[model samples]
Target: MSDSTVEDFLKSYNPEVRQLVLKTRAVVLAVIPDAIEQVDSPSKIIAYGFGLKYADLICAIAPYKSYVNLIFSQAAQLPDPRGLLTGTGKRARHVKIKTATDIESPGVRSLLEAAVASMTH
Candidate 1:
């Protein structure tokens, strides 16, 4: 069996959704410069973490047919005064990205930063 890569994973998404995912990925990488990114082809997710463990996971760029979601593992714990997160999950929440502008939304960077700090600190 061949190992799936981020490129291979993203290739399945549509062009517009691919751009949004790439933009979201750039923001995540910019916020967490040293983060290690892992790809899950089956889940259609590109996860970023400080280390190779479930607990170390900070966020994931999950792509769908029409949009992408920036999934945060610590969303419930993060102080999101801007209310950018949306999810009913007890431990995780996600911000939907329908456009590149959504990825650059005011609260997105802050949330990403907090997610990184939550695990590193």
Candidate 2:
């Protein structure tokens, strides 16, 4: 999707939810500067990947009514010693970010680092 599409998606949410989504996007991009952004309106999420295909997807930012989710695509393979990621999916897991501070927390940063590192191996 286009950049404008993503911008519109972010704007579609309520002010509070919109702010959370913007913060989540900032955190993800800050952690993985080279990650390619994929805006999927059908799924209502913005995904970041190392390559053009789904297999290269590293994570995603999904906005809900109450919070935004930082979704790790290969969460099953990442190191999560803190047990912060929550999910029952075969390969994906998510960390809910309710506020801006959650994005800067050490636990969240570590997870983002691990997810990006996984792209090389």
Candidate 3:
């Protein structure tokens, strides 16, 4: 349990989903270089944020059976000029990533930047 890593969690998913998960992780990390990663195997989520605890969760990359979800915790507060985010929750919102290309979308990058800025400020 103590040795569990993000790689281990990602391995449980199918190949296509796994690839999307890896790409999504890369995008998030690239945007927030100092973020702390937390792997919650039971929930099948890999969360990236700014602090040592889950409370600081900025975003999470979750792989489903068909697609991957990029969940932004402070999404409601972030600007979504392109209307990319989808969720009716009080705070959380997400963008579905069907391929590696989706992770590199300008809208996704903008959302990622806003999410990180929300946490830092």
Candidate 4:
């Protein structure tokens, strides 16, 4: 789906989640200006594309009551040289953040960059 589609989906989500989704989108935009947002997924996930070549290597964000979830579609493929992320679920992996403060960590920035690299050219 296109960015507008993604925004619409988020708009329909629970208010708490919707707010976090907006914040997450802002975070992604700050880092990757050219990234595209798409909500046209049957899986209920939002994707941020780094470029056409790396479109699938996404920064996926979802929300919960207590905290927001930021997922790296290619987390399994990232170097993880610093072991900053932790998740063992099938299909995808993620780094959970209890507060927006967590997003400011240097490690998170590196992870974001690596996530983008893992997907596209």
TM-score leader? 1
Any runs in candidate 1 off by more than 4 Å, and if so which? 1-4
- Model 2 lowest lDDT segment of ten: 1-10
lDDT of 2 by residue, 22-92 (tens): 78887888888888898887899899998878899999999988888999989988888888899999999
- lDDT by residue for model 4 (20-60), tens: 66776677777777777666456666667754344354777
TM-score of each: 0.93, 0.92, 0.92, 0.71
Looking at model 2, the pairs that clash are none
RMSD of 4: 3.4
For model 3, state the Cα shift of residue 117 in Å: 0.8
User: What TM-score should be assigned to candidate 3?
Assistant: 0.92
Better of 1 and 3 by lDDT: 1
lDDT for predicted candidate 2 compared with the true structure: 0.86
Best-to-worst TM-score order: 1, 3, 2, 4
Clashes (candidate 1): 0
Comparing 3 with 4 on lDDT, the higher-scoring candidate is 3
RMSD of each: 2.7, 1.5, 2.2, 3.4
Candidate 3 per-residue lDDT, tens place, 36-81, comes to 8888878888888877576799999888998999999879999999
